[model samples]
Target: MPRTESPRRGRRPGDSGTREAILDAARARFSTAGFRDATVRAIAGDAGVDPALVMHYFGSKQALFVAAMEFPLDPAEVVPRLVAPGVDGLGERLVRFLLGVIDELGDANPMLALVRSAVGHPEAARMMREFLGEAILDRVASAIDTDRPRLRADLCASQIVGILVARQILELPELAAADRETLIGVYGRTIQGYLTGPLESS
Candidate 1:
């Protein structure tokens, strides 16, 4: 009888298990190393899958980030909505959009996962800071033509971050029970002050 060849073995391409493994690896990389450092090769290595599999499952790094973050909407589109109301009501518009996303998740806030995973990791923290500052909050401040654009942006970020941590992560009853309009009104006002109100003593 002819000798039989050994069977080729490894994860099949594009299997759901492989995709989940990639997601798990991606979460780990992004939470520890941040987006820029979390390359396909590194993630694939961690996932024990082919690098090409990662690309096959997720078209690009950005697409991977969007998937990992479970982001509800496109910032490019939603960010402009934050700007649509102009300077005066920018804060309110932003709050509505953001909290609306949380609402969409029902029981889970995807952002909470990002924050918890990134809080202790310096690279992850930096990525989160950059994202919030550059992608979301900063754009609003820049759009509003605020007196101190960067400062206002940072302040706005802090407010929203605090809310996310408290309401969603910490599960504060007062915040969790509050209706959307109420939260929006309160947070919106607070953010409005950060956006346009005077921070310095008169």
Candidate 2:
């Protein structure tokens, strides 16, 4: 008899395809069910793999989310750099940096995905809140040498998130049509106020 070869079976344990599949599944699950509700088993099922595989590849649900979402920029590194130059013109730098990110990423922006999902899902909203509070807001707050740094950070977040929602999510005509520099100048002033100016009723 001639030699015979057995057919290859399922994907190997360390297959890159397997990893990508899990990531794709995770993105869909997180988008649809939100982070808190999207279980590892469900995501693994979506990817046609075992939940153990998902855990093996991603380490944890939060890590899986961070990987799946894929931010265009890392806030931990970028925020520190932005704040390292001190608070002077920090508002403009911040707005400019954000606009640059949005413009560069365009439709592929993960922030857009986050804001969109957060609108209808409370779980997603909590995810966004925690992410912003910890990653971006807290860093900015700590950098400021002023009273109520947390309040200032939160105020800046409100403005920034509002712009994202208006321009990207709601597609407001005015914001959508406005050029980047124009929006930067307008929003930067307000954000500058929040970051350093007086918060009193005087």
* Candidate 1 structure quality by residue, lDDT tens digits, 51-113: 887898887776676777777655656787768768888889879888888888856766887
Segments in model 2 whose C-alpha atoms lie over 4 Å from true places = 1-65
lDDT of each: 0.77, 0.84
TM-score of 1: 0.70
Instruction: Give the residue spans of candidate 1 off by over 4 A.
Output: 1-29, 36-64
**C-alpha displacement of 12 in model 2, angstroms?**
11
User: Given candidate 1, what's the lDDT at residue 29?
Assistant: 86
Per-residue alpha-carbon lDDT of candidate 2 for residues 31-99, written as tens digits (9 for 90 to 100)? 667656779999988887788988988787767877877875667678999999999899999999999
